[model samples]
Target chain A: MGNADSLLQAEGLSRDYEHYNAVQDYQLTLKRGEILGLLGPNGAGKSTTLRMLSGTLAPSRGAISIKGIDLLQQPRRAKQSLGYLPDQPPLYFDLTVEEYLGYCGRLRGIRKADVEPAIQRVIKTCSLEEVQKRLISHLSLGYQQRVGIAQAIIHEPDLVILDEPTKGLDPIQINAIRDLIRNLAEQHAVILSTHILSEVEAVCNRVQIINQGQIVHESQLGIQEPDKVFFQLHLARPPETAQIEALQGVESVIAQDKGRYLISVENAQAGLQIVTSAIIQNNWGLLGLCPQHESLEQTFMQKVFQEDRP
Target chain B: MIGLITRFEYRRLFLSPLAWTLIAGLQFILALLFLVFLENFITELQPRLALIDDAPGATDTVITPMLIWAGILWLAVIPLLTMRSFSEERLYQRQALLMSSPISISEIVMGKYLGLLLFLATALSPTLLTAVSLSTGTQLDWGKLIAGFMGLYLMLASFSAAGLFLSTLSRQPAMAAALSYGLLALLFVFYITGKTQGSESVLFIYLSHFGHFLNLSSGLVYSSDILYFLLFSTGFIILTIQRLDSDRRNG
Candidate 1:
């Protein structure tokens, strides 16, 4: 079931192979104007989930609703609201960029009268103006990617799903695409899947890390305040672990060898003040204190690799 | 939506040089055959033209044979033309685009079928026009010409449908073409068996398309013959749609 405010909602989504699950019990909800990034390694079910969302693949069990329309029951109507760019851009090399985009617009059920204007809008938005007349096969890789995006958004769908939108591109083109995605999210609920973490930090507001066909971690990107903060401190004479744990903002304190203490603080700024004051009052000489953050890269690696540990 | 797909397919086929080249080559070959047959008729059958009350004229002696030759040509060419319908999409991984679109599988199959039919009709037009032009110089039977054309059109439609169906089964266009040829050859082989003992095996003669196609070409329009063509084309088209639906479900 979709919430009134949700632009897209999926529940209990699962796709199964003969003996393995490709994706299992996946849930997602995206509000209008929100960009959700799906991050995962190869064969981690990001593409499979996106394919199901785009109505191209049937899930073994799931319910997907786009703008209050059920995907399985009314696929055509539901798909009318979706725009998808597969991991490999599905392009017709023989057609010109303009012609290809026009076909895409009509393929999405855009009105005949509206297809021309829609093509023009996507072409301009994707920066495909200069090569609109050129055959897709003749264009450079960057331009082909642009044309791929143009085709996806030509129908002005409410939900845009992109898989590896910037898989292979120079830094300059990547930046341009990042900006274009930001603009697209202003009007549509966008779900972007990529292996690149920087892309999520640069364009996505929220990120989900998928591992072994399941979402293992999800968090907001570029938030001002961290959810949990860690600190590594060395002391000449360390206090007891309970003494540190008793501090106002301290969540946990673990003793390390060689007179080191590891503290988890719920609020780093306030905890820094309390811990420091307590250390000074107790006369336990604070050798060094460094605040540590769990970056997205670390979180991703931990979640993906932690399962491998016995 | 189906109309849009059909129109889009037609434009794509027209823009491709392969379709044009095939049409031009067929026209050239038919023209040469036309002249050679017309010369043969003038020399051998001119004196006997008025001997019987009803005798074979230009439409029979020349046009019908020419159409049969064109029919044989289509056996090879239609497979090439229709091989790319879905096979190329699979080869380039562009099936995602069409499969992801909101259109139903039936619409996609019908669109490709109609598009290829239009292209085949355009390619066969020049040869038909040449046969029509024979009336200006000598007596011609419009009924026989039309029946022959209807037979040719039906055969092309069936061949193209089978080829399109084969295309959905493989990603390699050449392999699709080969499979389509194999199917047509199977049909022809069955027809050849029936020919060995004319009318002895009613089942074999009726099962093969050759007897029915020849029946129609000789100005015999049986409802059964038309039904055979319709069922042949529709059966393959339905199979193609079902194949796509299964791929979506399974993949």
Candidate 2:
């Protein structure tokens, strides 16, 4: 969705804590306007990775570059194009929304003359106009989260890193923040860590699931994998497992209910005719037949709990 | 970037009532001490004038005591004011906001130090009023008063720098404040040890800050004394910067 030049490129990023490696050999390349979802379980080093990317925590080894500028060597120059929000919104409780945003803009090297206009732009974009004059301590959790995002974008950074952007919020607030994040991606490349699978599906263009400090899976959205598709069938008289297993392109069969079974197919379109024909010819009295696409939950569980795999 | 951080910190200091309360409460105590010293000076003035050709004037007797009271007040007040400088941000997990910005750690430390210095300057301004008001009726030694205030400023700057360094060491604001006060007290009491250990021990005399401040408070503006304060405060500020830089590597 962007040009050939990626906005963020991190290679071989790793952090060691004397006893174990928190994050190991991490790699990422994000283009402009791409929403990359970082999916991981607890103790998966997601926050540690984000912290290293943001320059808050130094990596034990490896290198990160933002817009082709080395993060470690030219941090000040590289940070100009980066904005990061940690897991908790870092707000100065005594300052109002406008005051805090203004401070953030100038701290990021925004010109004094341009700070006000930039703050106004983010206030409008984050829908924080009403609470612009209210102290952050007085605002609700949702508005505080909005203010957090507003500070990140106040400098108009090209790469925005958010660690658990929607960690705590009601359903409506989460939806609002999700929409705001999607809107942010129109101008900035966003990388957010979240536990909400639905949120990733709704807003992310690409997802990378990490387990045990490694990227276990990565895929782009809207492209279905037919090879992994399976079918669920209910019948009055089900056939033997060996009979279904003998059919061409069928991987396995498992009995589910009194007369139901889940059939794993190598290819959904090609295996459909063979499995249905066998069931009908056997007089199994097929009552229901439907494709069951694998959900991200299954993929996440499989990736996290598979002990033998790295 | 340093200026931006300084302004933000100043705003925070302005909003917190703790700063105002400390300043106001100290001013009240100094004023009360001023009256007591003035009454004692007035009662013994005539006897001293009759006995000696040049008696100690109001600046020597009254202003000096008031300045000493100001010093004592600051020994306690500076720590209270600077307790939340870097420690509070760390405690609240907001250090990332400043550390991750383009601004360097030295700039952050300088900005915080300057912000607290400005607040201390303003908070202690009223104590100078007590010294200046003596000009209306009695002779005031302007040079001595200036030197005394200069000493107070230097002492307060060193205290603030030390407090700032201690703040960087701990995440709890109260612990920072207590440690700073305890350290300052330890330094203050070294004067007694310096006397007992004799004049040959340069380390005890120099480390305490007692002799240097005394020289300045007595209107003796020796370059050596000024240099001592300058280097002392700079040492603490440098220590603070070093600690903050290490956090980047350690975190």
Candidate 3:
């Protein structure tokens, strides 16, 4: 099913290599201003899926519609709204940054008059102003990556797909690129694949973990409902699990080692108030209390490695 | 889109030292050959030609042979020029930029083809100037010179088209160049075999590029020869487009 306002939609996408299938029945629907992080291990078809979505690689058996235009039937029109950066940055090393971006702008069908402004805008956005006139081969890896991103967005496409935008970079460069991606999400729907788990947690509002050429897990990030809250509690005076479970909004309590307890509750705010008061009244000294959600790293590990245990 | 790609490719061609080196080297070789041809015409053929009526002029004695030599030189040079057209892009993974840019395969192929053709035309300019210089000292056959240049250009176009197709088939530029040289040399072999075999193998001669090129370079603009070049270039260009389309489809 396609959404009218969606920027990208694909159904039943599959890619078959010579001896085996690389991707199978991949599906995605991205609305405007949404960033979808695709996370997968090595050889998990993330690149293949992104390549198909960006109209660079054709799918064997599926339909993809970009801004409601069928990619297979009307690829040129559909691709006008799409931009992609593959795993390796597709750069002509001989051209300068400004020249390359200008070419990309023209290639993306920006008018001659608008190409300069588009180049300027992306140059400023990607913080490439100082090195704009330098040859791309002379730039460092970080700047090269920024230039790659600049070209992808120079045309102001509705959808931008990037494969491993920050695979090899220092922490500072990674943060800078993350900030750029976040800024891009303000206007364009972004789909990026990364090996870093925290990258998804930091930048993406939604994430999908793919393994074995199929999406194994998908969830919204940092948007948990109040009812599904878990709190880790440490008390100086030990208490039985039954006593904590008796608190009014508390769903269950599991005791951990060293006076620590993991408690699930119906509502986070009400449960915190009830549990704190109960602990004070019972004279069980509260050592530490904090809301603890399941980290994405654990989920990724389980979803990726669990399936491998045949 | 094609114009944008063509312009960018043309500009990029000039940015690399390889193009400049090839152009300079070709000019040096051709200029030396022009002198040798000029010296031979003056010292050995001038008196013999004076005794005969309707004798071969400078255009026939000097320009035609030089043009033929230029054509043969380009058979090797065009492959080096066209080898990087698609092969380098595919090797560096830069082809995705174009493939995803809302441009069709034909536009990409034609854009690259025209860009290389433009550069080859530029490389051919020195030879034309050398031939035109003869007009200052003697009567020059302008028709034959133009016909010879046209034939050489068409032959280069066919060589580049085939080279572009071979570039699409390989990721390494060296491999593409070798394949192109092999294919062009095979055509030359066909020409030699057809000439030696005489009337028995008309098809081979017709199929060979040299036969049509020779017809055009001899001040003969046969419609069949022009059509053969047109069909040969268009056929290879179409094959390049189909190969790229299949690469995208099956990738």
Best by TM-score: 3
- The per-model lDDT (C-alpha) reads 0.88, 0.85, 0.90
- Evaluate fnat for each of the predicted models and list the values in order: 0.66, 0.63, 0.83
lDDT of 1 by residue, A245-296 (tens): 8989899888999879888998878888999999999999999999877778
Tens-digit per-residue lDDT, B1-251, candidate 3: 77877877888899999889988898899999999999999999998999999999989999999999998887877888888989999998888999889888899888988888888888889889999999998999898889999999999988889999999999999999999999988999888888894445788899999999998899999999999999999999999999999999999
Model 1: residues with Cα > 4 Å off, grouped in runs: A231-291, B198-200
Q: What is the lDDT for B140 in model 3?
A: 92
Compute DockQ for each candidate against the true complex: 0.66, 0.61, 0.85
**Higher-ranked by TM-score: 1 or 3:** 3
Give the per-residue lDDT of model 2 (tens digit) for A164-250.
888667788788888988888898899999877888888898999888898998888655565666788898887777888899999
Across A219-268, the per-residue lDDT of candidate 3 in tens digits comes to 98876574678989999998888988888999988899989999888888
Q: What is the interface RMSD of candidate 1, in Å?
A: 1.1
Per residue, candidate 1 scores C-alpha lDDT tens digits across B59-89 of 8889988988898887778888888999998
